[model samples]
Target: MKIKQLKVRNFRLLDNMVLNIEEDITLIVGKNNTGKTSMFEAINIFVKTQEISFEDFSQSTYFIFNRLLRLINQVDFNSISERRKEIVEKVIQNQMPKVQLFIEVEYDVTNDSLINLSEFITDLDENRNDATILISYESNNSLSLLFSFLNREKQEISLIRWLKDNIKAFYQTKCFAVDKDSDFKKDIDLSFKSKIEKIVSFEDIKASRTLDDTKSDKNKTLATGFSHYYRERDQTKEDIKKLEETLTNVSIVLKGEYEKVLKDVISDLNNFGVSTPITIPQIEIDSEFNSESVIKNNIKYYYKHESINLPESYNGLGYSNLIFMVLELTSFIERFKNSSEEKKSEFLTILIEEPEAHMHPQMQQVFIKQITKKINKAREEGINIQLIITTHSSHIIAEAGIDLDKGFDRIRYFNKIDGRLEISDFNNFRHKESDKETFRFLKQYLNLHKCDIFFADKVIMVEGVTEKMLLPIMINNVANSLNNEYISILEVGGAYTQKFKELLHFIKVKTLIITDIDSVDGNGEECKTDFANAETCNSTLKDWIPKKNTIDELINCNEEEKFDTEFIRVAFQIAEHSNTYVGRSLEESIINKNLIFFKSEYTKDAINKKVKSLFTLINQHSSENLLIKTPWDLRPKSSSSKTNFSFDLMTFDEKETGLNWEVPLYIKEGLEWLAGICMVNISEK
Candidate 1:
């Protein structure tokens, strides 16, 4: 039987969160401290590999002293008469609020043994082949006893004794597995021990950070199959002696061989010195090769070079971790295979944290794609193994994205909502079945470099490479900070920017789209005359995003001329410095504001020469009195690009010139809006 779902309450960060586990493998991913580790801890505690500690209590849950203090703060002791106020204070100080957890677990009941063992089946969907069990565990504090102690008027009753008694009353967790049909209060005798022990077992392999050699490392005793070997065989006096003798014989043989070579050297040295003879020192051997030392001395890691052994530690960290992981995984399988039949527990949940710890990106992808199959093949003894991996690696997530056909729904996304942890299924982002097609498209498009958008606090969707290169610099200037907030500027292009709408919406990150109006004629060429929307601007946007009713409202607010906010979180605005005229592209919109800085820096520069020529042509062509109001106006009709222009602006020596490069009005406004919204979104939690 596999675990289907977990519902936890009053746990750390998981004040109320439900996690749905996929059958074969479930990948849990999120930013750090969003409760990825807490989710695992809740499950681990429920399954009892680990028990709940005092610190595991949710931040919302108050302890005895804190609860009493809150109550004291709420009361007006001065309002009552002096003696009565003292009694009111005593009453408030005497009691505390209790912290309780109501955890519900559901399992897919394929095994007959589990069905027979479970006395509390909350749900049994015959069509789905599943059974669910609800468990309620709580920390108890006796309020009646506290009231009794306060009501008694004894002369010289120690407050310390009363506090100690109340504190002890709340220290223990009372657990009960709840049955659906029966009264929950009456079913206090229910325990999960008989049910869980018969059906499931848990194994957690935390993120491995080995500081020393694996052979002697206590943290990874299974690295060389030493743990498995020890488990299978018992060591006695004879075993110890044999291990010691093995070491002794190897030492003696090596020492003899060394002495043969040293014999000639000593004689030659004695002749040269004309004094006492020098010789190689005798090799030392321990009297007893203990279990710990035996493995360290005998199980040496080596690489073969010309049939010679080289130390494995001599390799890179990536290689060492790869080898260590392989060995540990093999040992885990062997241990599962060799389990006795009488135990009646055959299921294992393997919790792996950051399996891509030391591996390169390619190896990280390979690990995610192949590790599950390897685990399944290794568990040939018919032991059921479920894999739950937590990772921050983009390569691994990409591999998972590619495997949508198999189990994309298995990926669990964890995020915090207003300081409370929320776990959502991967399918929650899929608005419809057609979104799976978009998923395929996105999976192909998001490579290692682009996939970093998934981790950013906020995102800005731009039309081309120019915006991607220049926007971050503009944002740093507007926000007046560098690297304080991570912003991903993706060049999704105008035509396909809508592809990421649902994804950005579901991730709940604020994103701004700085798109051009793209005013086009009937032939779909750039509009040469007056700007009017027929095949471009709001009409194209409306056609691209028909479902968003909000953009229709933005059009009512005159979107034909300038960019405007479609919504608070996701905004779409035309790239323009002024409403009087529009730029066809991002570079065109801001070029005028940049001319003064560029001209002063280098007049003889080749790029500036091209810019000057383009400006002269624009001035000659314009019949109207246009003063080159924006950068887009001076953009050349030829293949002259803005990438180099932006590069020059970014790399300009401000300290040498003692002048700051001015950011264009439109660009600055868009960046500031992005920064403001992102800051607000982040501050929400």
Candidate 2:
């Protein structure tokens, strides 16, 4: 049994979000400030409702009353009497906004370990074995009559309260059907509260909580568990009484040994024939023995390595924090086991935030994997367990990967869209029954660059390594727009660029795809083809974007024209240029546009001896033959080799040609397009 779904409203950035839980391990991942933490907090608030603090409220909630005050004052509140202002202020204080969290859980009805929750389980809808718990923190509204005389304020308060309360009805949960305009409000009945208490063992391991302060205090660590296990579980009071008696007897015996050791030390000193016998001061040892004093005063945890023993706090933060997490996990599991079958619950949910904190990259990767495996092993031993991890570590996600067979999704993505928190589930991103191997490759590719896709304000996907290496320089020097945009140039190549189509759309970043126009001169009939597979224009780029949506005609005639044009017109320019490449690849296009630079930079043998003009050059060599390296060829792997060759030409242009190399028309047009779109968005903002 596990949490089947979660719906949250007015909780920080997550104004309204519904998340489906289909895996044993659910990874919440996204860029920072995208409400990943907010989602986690919402779950925490639901699971630990009695433990709510003022800080748990959303940032927007705190400003709600203040904003209302300003609005009221600006309109007509200044004309009100001083007594009216005080009443308005008092009412405002008590009418601050609220946050709510709703959770849908799937549980096994036959699990005897959860007998304490049997009543609530029976109360669930007869058609389904699921339950929905709506936990909310709302302001007390017992003072509604005070606003009646100021009738406008009454309407405002009533509407705001209705908006806050009725929005819960908008969420559809597993247990109940919700209409958008439904007015049902869930009060925590005894059965519902019992289910919340017994059905799930939800524990939150916050990132901010560290071992530094409590490492030396062994009693604080053990007291809760000790009290719960020995005192809470044992209905018979005789067990604690037996424990007290055993401790008292043990203390007396231990004190005798201590006295014997002191006497022996004094005797040894006298036998050594010292001039004066050293007087030893006797210290009082507490005779009264209780669990608190015994554990707190006598027991202390220390880090042991071979013959070395150091206090727990003496270790480095990474080691200590890992140990602390392990201790917490073990204690949680043991507490679940310690309870009697009738009182215990079978389902446990653990929420971990930023598990990579205080750990190195390698440790971060290994830690989560090991912990997840252990958690699954625990699940196999009869406890139904689910782990929720919120992380920014690509290493952790890569290690976890996407394994539907083992119930691991490819980490949900969260981001802010239109100033609201929106999440795209990994399960929805791809089909669950699809080939897992391709998904593995995608994760590996994304993990290689540490998922830089999250950092870009806009993204440019390119087919080759050369494009990835040189696009930044072109954007900076030729386009002069590097500072204006934060763009990620991903070298996913043409074949796999489609893998990121859904991802880019989810992040909602502007994306430009640049690929080579691998044209084939088939019997002098020009047909565009894919570079890798040699299929006639069957590229991932084609699959991702429609030809109709793109420019109808190629802008290839102006091989040297600059595009100081409208953003929409220039936005996808190079894709159109590819349509006009009769038989030229990106490398061929570069050489054709800058023949003088290529000819002067490379050896004379590298160029076709018979070729003199750009027109003759295209006619003489097919795209494939132009780049095929022979012994006489000066460049290695012509397509990729052009990157270094062009780089050299750009670097030493003044020395060789006594002028800076002119930016290629296609490259300039593409960069300008990307920059223009970014500039337009910035200006609009």
TM-score of each: 0.72, 0.63
Q: Write the per-residue lDDT of candidate 1 for residues 1-685, one digit (tens) a residue.
A: 6666666766677777777776667888776678777766776666664555556657665455455544555666557688876676556533433334343334455544555435545445465444445444443434334445556477366443454444444455444555434554324343555455556666666785563444434443233545444443434448856866787887668776766767776665556634447554544323333554557445664667787875654556666666566555655655565666665464666787878887898888777667766766745656677788888777877776436475346667776656767566766655546676666667667743566565566677777766777776777677655257666677787767777766665665556677654555766676522444434444325544322223224333332223222322333433234343444555554554545543332233445442332233333434232354444445644434466555655675576555466555555655676666333322220
Sequence-dependent TM-score of model 2:
0.63
List of clashing residue pairs for candidate 1 = 563-574, 588-632, 590-631, 591-631, 592-630, 592-631
Per-candidate Cα RMSD to the true structure, in Å, reads 9.6, 10.8
**Which number leads on TM-score?**
1
**Clashing residue pairs found in predicted model 2:** none
lDDT of 1 at 372: 67
Whole-model Cα lDDT per candidate?
Answer: 0.57, 0.56
- Please, what are the lDDT tens digits per residue for candidate 2 over residues 385-427? 7888888776777677444344235467776655777777766
Over 4 Å off in model 2, which ranges? 49-97, 112-125, 142-186, 189-195, 209-317, 340-343, 404-410, 430-458, 471-489, 502-510, 523-543, 546-552, 556-640, 646-685
lDDT of candidate model 2 versus the reference: 0.56
